[model samples]
Target chain A: MSEPPQEQPRPEAEIDTPPRGLPQPEPAAQPPVPAADSGAAPGPGAGAAPVWGAGPPAPPTPQRRRASTVHVLQVIALVVGLVGTGWISSEHFRTVWLGSERDEPVAVDGAGAATHEGLTVSLVEATDLGATPSLPGTDWQPPSGFHAWRVVLDAESTNPDLFACDVALVDGGGRHFVANLFVDSFVDGFEWTFSCGVPEPDDDVPAQQALLVLVPADAEPTAVEITSTGFSSGYIELEID
Target chain B: MRRRWMIVGLAALAVVLGIATNVADARLLPYGPTSSTGAIGEDAGAYPFTVHVSQAQAAHTVLVCCRFETPPPTGTDGVWVVVTLSYATADRPRGASGTGLVLRSADGREFPVSNRTGSGGWLAGPDIWVRGDLAFEVAPDALEGLTLVFDPGIQLYGPMPTQYARIPLDLDPGAVLDVIELSEEQILGAGER
Candidate 1:
């Protein structure tokens, strides 16, 4: 009553103070620090304390989370892609190294002997018969535009059983020529001998055979290939001079 | 580190499995029989039938004096070889076609059976004992170390590996083969020795 006791003005610091039991607003830069003296449990209370400051801690700066997720996805894709590429490359190499190797003929020097499956073959000599070559006993002559070649070889069988083989000539242009069959008169007259199949080899000597091949005059023989009749993969090749 | 080891283990397993598959595929492929030769009178089982060579003779000429539904062409001048065989089937009887007789000289010349001579012995079905003669014409000088090769007919679809029954016709180098004549009835009926 003496002029309503003349209410006194509050101090500035007291005017700015928040009410009790309400959360205090923290600075924008620093998150609110939890009260260690308080009896609250650790984990849930610590998480809630950050939410009370600066409007939920600015949603944890979404850039870092998104960037980490993208990084993990990129790593997974890279690993999967690398495994797939490696598998494909390995298969390609396997086929090239093993599967496709048979198409190439086995290479041997002109004087070397090539062996396969208990059989050995060597080219002794190759003779090119010029045009108008004479037959030993017959008056017959080779057809025009065709030339003859006589191939001499030694075939030895190391196995106890008999061995049969085939002979073919590969020209420089990759053409194959078989032994002449139609010129029986000349073959029979010349006394030229060939072993169709070799008997078991003796300790001292192997069977020697001769073949007569007729080819066009322009063909140039590069190699002679010998193969077993039953198997196509195994072969013996001897280069010609 | 454990995950890395797991990945490496899986990769190794994949490679092993691939190699195993390749090996299995190679092993399972169909292969032909190895080339083989047998003597006369030996039972050379060429599948579906068994072949036996009883006798071989060399002759200067072959005369087909037999009656025929279709008489074969006549052969002259060249040396003739007569080969006798008894073909029998064990389980299933099969009719066979084509000639499998070939004459091989010591120098590796091959002369097939002559179609000119008439021999009525054709292949028949199972349990049937068929005997007949096949004649081949060759040069007179080709008689030494003459061998008759019997092979089964070739298969068009699969591998055609030839197994030969080599019957040595031990003809004297200087011996003269006489001219022989056979009647059509004698040739058609089980051949006369």
Candidate 2:
């Protein structure tokens, strides 16, 4: 209203005029941040103020998309970490639990007999004729009446050389006696078994005495000994059945 | 929105953890496969005997002997003795078999002895051990004696005799004899339990 209407100002003339110490406006819109300003705090001479005539403001669509992509990457990282931890734990457990199954036999010296389900028995005996008479405690008593007595004798020779053993059963009366003496196979030494049945003496016999003795006729007891060194030097199981 | 997502994640994780723990437990827990039964074995050269004691069984002692020869090693040639007892009360003096019992050796072997003859002695079969089930009949009362002798086998070592003397007296009711000498003291002590 203050200016004359005859000379009308052109609408595009003001846009073309360059302002002092400022850039001309671009037709396309541009974001406020510069390449140098990326990831930096705004400063007095750097990213603080927007360029005077850079362009119209841009929409926030691209930035929102980038934020959503970052969220997806975080979820992927969490899943990978969990899987790695589980795999390591499983490997560790497998190494710790295991067992062995097998049967092993143990060997022992002196009367070695092992039984798994049922018993397996063996017997051995040795004697020296010279040592027989030297034994201590010479006492014996015979059972009364017509009694039946059975005795089994087994012997093995330890030395590579052959040997023989003689077993004698002397009745309560020094006059009557029974004897079983035999020579065994010498190839693998000697393993012999002798069994005898003795008849019972009369009940009226006065304080009868019985003595059983073993004598090595051909070899000494030192040459042939039982598997168990712990033996009585000579002991026998006496069963009255 | 963040809080809501966190709550949903936590709930899903809890369900997954519950399933994993339960699944592992179910897969790992079950009984093992080995079910063992009793089978007893006897010593190879073991001799069997039966004894009967009566008032007439006075004065002279009865003796049954088994001699063992020495093998190269003592353990190779050895013997073991096992016994069983059966009785009849004043009402019934004749005993029954099978009900008597079974005994075993150091190793697991079944030695079955029948109480067939109430007044006679019953020798054990070839086996040397008592089965776990029939062990009751061999309860200390059944034992008479155990003897072991080492003999010379193919290779002559020497003769050694091992004997354990045992007896069954008129055992007093409600009385027990702690057989301290049966084995080592520690082993007998543990058995007290």
Candidate 3:
């Protein structure tokens, strides 16, 4: 109870109180800080204690006080925004560059069926046309040292939005090739439409397409994956029979 | 005193911002397309093709080339602006693929070639002249100061072309016709390189 106001510490670094040299209250009128007199640690730098009669430290004016608070809020928001942006950028790198497949892809057997968005794609059959694959009506043949792999798929979607699809093949060694890389837009009478068939406004029959791909004869392709932009999750990997 | 200076600074900032906005609206941005301007009845180099626009006409109904007899012409919401041009490639063989012609109006609006009317093209070799009719459906009010941006060497699935020819057409708004008969595109063989 006998500790002088000059010996009491100031509350916070940012609270701007009057200079310590200013006139203070009488020793008897000055309230003692319990912690200071009770042999406990005083408030941070409480050694400079606020001037006796002067209340708590504040900005010079009410407007300045508001401005100070706004500055503190702005700093907090800027730090939070920077942290959020960094987190998103790291996640993007992981998904695109590092090839961290966020979730396991939805996989089906060689001839199984799977639904994505509103479209259900079914792999009917896959055939390996070795070296030289010639259709009955056309004379188109694979180039030298190339093997033709044919894929027949049935795409059916009741929705008229007409979702487009991409068909790709992944070899046993993990080499990926898009459908059109080796095959023409049309092959063996059936058109390799990148789009799932246009189900008539009233008809329910699915559109069937026969796609062909030419790969190096030595390469062993293991799976054909079908993906649509409509699906945000991973693509569907259908094993090659 | 500081308040007066602050007001002056704000006014200056507003003036600078207004000027910047006007410049951006005038298509002066660095990312905007660079144009190769050409006038009607002039030899305009639209990428690989040197296009010579002979005439520009307006029609209410247009019988597009090839299959006009099967589908026939019908009433359209906008007038068809047909530009009859003779083009020849000077460089290597280039395929005139996809929708490459666009009509830029006086008010900065652009109308691409009507793809629904089946606009597609074949290959033209070095020095081979091709006679074709490029038609764009546009509102009658945009006829004034209409400029055609033709990029004949556009790719079907790749990065966009860098530059295109801007041909200004001298159109007659009062000359709206019933139907314009558009014939098939003729690939006139080489002579002028």
By lDDT, the best candidate is 3
Tens digits of per-residue lDDT for model 1, B15-107:
999988666544543322323355566655554455666767777777665655534435567788777766754332343343666888999
Residues B8-64 of candidate 3: C-alpha lDDT, one tens digit per residue = 998999999998876764465332433567777777766556777778888998886
TM-score of each: 0.33, 0.18, 0.36
RMSD of each: 22.6, 25.2, 15.4
Writing each residue's lDDT as its tens digit, candidate 1 over A1-241 gives 3565566766855544544565555567654544544455764335443433333235556898998899899899989999998887677456555575454456554458876656767888777775466656666454555566777887766644434565667777555555543244345423233443446345323355667765556668888877655444657778886
**Model 2 interface DockQ:** 0.01
Judge candidate 1 at residue A49 and give its lDDT.
34
Instruction: Evaluate model 2: give its TM-score.
Output: 0.18
lDDT of each: 0.60, 0.28, 0.66
Model 3 docking tier (incorrect/acceptable/medium/high): incorrect
> What lDDT tens digits, residue by residue, belong to model 2 across residues B1-193?
9879999999999999999766654453231111112111221221121111110111111122213632221110112122222111111012123322334333434344322212222221111111111111223322332112111111111121211111222323233222111111010010011
The runs of at least 3 residues in candidate 3 whose Cα sits more than 4 Å from the true structure, single-residue gaps closed, are: A1-241, B1-34, B65-71, B152-161, B189-193
lDDT of 2 at A3: 75
RMSD versus native structure for model 3: 15.4
Docking class of 2: incorrect
